[model samples]
Target: MSRPDPVFPFFLDHPARVTSDRLELLTALVNGPRFDPMFRGDLLVVPPDHPVYRWQCRVGGCERPGQHHVELCFQQDREWAEARASGGNQAEFLEAATRRQHAGWSRFPA
Candidate 1:
């Protein structure tokens, strides 16, 4: 007898060799839908004149399809620090922290 594949075969930590439809279905099931901030292809990595930014997942480097980076706001700069750190996404601290650099979310590489 033949066996069926798992319903959700993709693991976030590992590379998934899944079809686009499968990935779309999974994303829709979970996050419903998300707007692509990288659509503009600007500041995808960071904003201009940013004091300091650290690239996350350095292991993946620029080669990764989706590069994650976050700005490093020092404690002394309370305004900027609080603004960046205010985001409630505890899962990815750096990811949330970097959001403060842009108006909303812009993927434009800068």
Candidate 2:
């Protein structure tokens, strides 16, 4: 018989591969989608009906109602950090971090 996927059939069926920042964002949105109606590009359209919008896949192809499909959110933040590391402060760092966190969820891998 053929072998199954290495990471499958474990305690967790399918674990998400989002970065630290993305996970933070998702946690915030999942907890309270009303906080940011238009986060990044994906709409936090969490109606009063369904509340638990867990991310199923990492390809962002699934028709899920949330932005949990994305896996990475580092490129933008890295760029921003590099460009402003000279004298940027906490606000700049936060802005870049936020942008990257959401951008990773919306932007497709290229």
Candidate 3:
């Protein structure tokens, strides 16, 4: 007959220890140099203008999350659609686009 796994009993008996160890490992990983500093904090706050991870609407002063594939937020995208239909180019739209207020969520420092 085959013997039972030795690790299962240890984990079952020391769940708190397991949890603490996992947290410790996670903390260490987060504090490590390889991890990006932007995501090291308790609250992840990516900058709107980050070169690699652009998270905000492209329109100036807009505070909405960008839609997938499209850089602009819902309102801006709708506005752009309407403007485009009227023969307005993206450059002109960007120049004349009105500043939008922050989304419902509270603002975090970049």
Candidate 4:
């Protein structure tokens, strides 16, 4: 008896079968209770305040997304650092920081 080829697997031989299996698996995953409702649709539009997917800056009126691990966006973070160095606190910074318009690329289409 001969062994099957490792490079060209039996599943790869049938494209339709593989596609169907993937669709079925995706459907089951989407239907699971643990799945987030925001991702169930064809277009994914996550809310800024989503607990697990928060992307926007937390400062009021700021339109940019947060940096990697911090809640403030890049510009806001820099501004905060400067203010803090000059003896300003978070509350004063939040009240004094200028509001920024959204970046061209960050805007979503209607």
Candidate 5:
């Protein structure tokens, strides 16, 4: 039996672009707003079809399928409860995720 190529197209499609250092930043924010103090313990889920879809383009080929990702929204929280109770859309509490690189292109420039 032959081993498969180490770098598969799918795996390369959305390689972990966020740097290890920035991972602390991204995960802290994404995991939950309480994880960080910027958004009042709110959680924003970027829809699978959010406009920032290109951020996940690993090869810059823009060939990945849409089903790969999903948008998440702040589903539960004290503020969310209050706002929803008052009939308000909490769009302002959401943010798009940014990609970062620790080693950067210099380490693997194409």
Candidate 6:
């Protein structure tokens, strides 16, 4: 059977516009926010229709000042608590959790 398409869609949508390295950079651009400190601890939940969304990032160190990408807010967040409990069902979830209780994202303010 054919494998599923990759998460990076440039190749399928704009094949003539970019090279492989461009794809790599685009992929990084899309996911890089997942590592910045301010975003790591926040929960990401979208409704079924995905409209009327709420986007929150903690206020702290970031290249774009006033926009935080690293934070310590997760320790008190209820979602964090529940996720940790649920994550325990997965193998070695504690060992795999991020320092700020996030999932594998960096904790540094840089």
Model 1 lDDT tens row, 39-93:
3344454533333443322221122222333323332134334554776333454
lDDT, model 6:
0.40
Which is superior by lDDT, 1 or 5? Answer: 5
lDDT of each: 0.39, 0.43, 0.84, 0.82, 0.40, 0.40
Best by lDDT: 3
User: Candidate 5 on 2-74: residue-level lDDT in tens?
Assistant: 9997655555655675355367977767677454342334564332233554223332222222223422222
RMSD of each candidate relative to the true structure: 15.0, 16.9, 5.6, 5.2, 20.9, 15.6
- How close is every model to the real structure, measured as TM-score? 0.18, 0.20, 0.60, 0.64, 0.17, 0.18
lDDT of 2 by residue, 6-108 (tens): 6454524445543555689777776684654434456444431233544322222332223333222344334445757777764555444433133334333
Model 4 regions more than 4 Å off: 1-26
How would you encode candidate 6's per-residue C-alpha lDDT over 15-79 as one tens digit per residue?
A: 66567768888667657856444233456433212123312223222111111222224442333
Look at candidate 6 and tell me the lDDT of residue 27.
66
lDDT of 4: 0.82
> Alpha-carbon error at 110 in model 4, in Å?
3.4
Off by over 4 Å in 6: 1-17, 34-45, 48-110
- In angstroms, the error of model 1 at 104 is 27
Model 5 spans with C-alpha error above 4 angstroms: 1-76, 93-110
Q: Which residue ranges in model 3 land beyond 4 Å of their true spot?
A: 1-35
C-alpha RMSD (angstroms) for model 3:
5.6
Candidate 4 weakest ten by summed lDDT = 101-110
TM-score, structure 6 vs. true? 0.18
**Ranking by TM-score, best first?**
4, 3, 2, 6, 1, 5
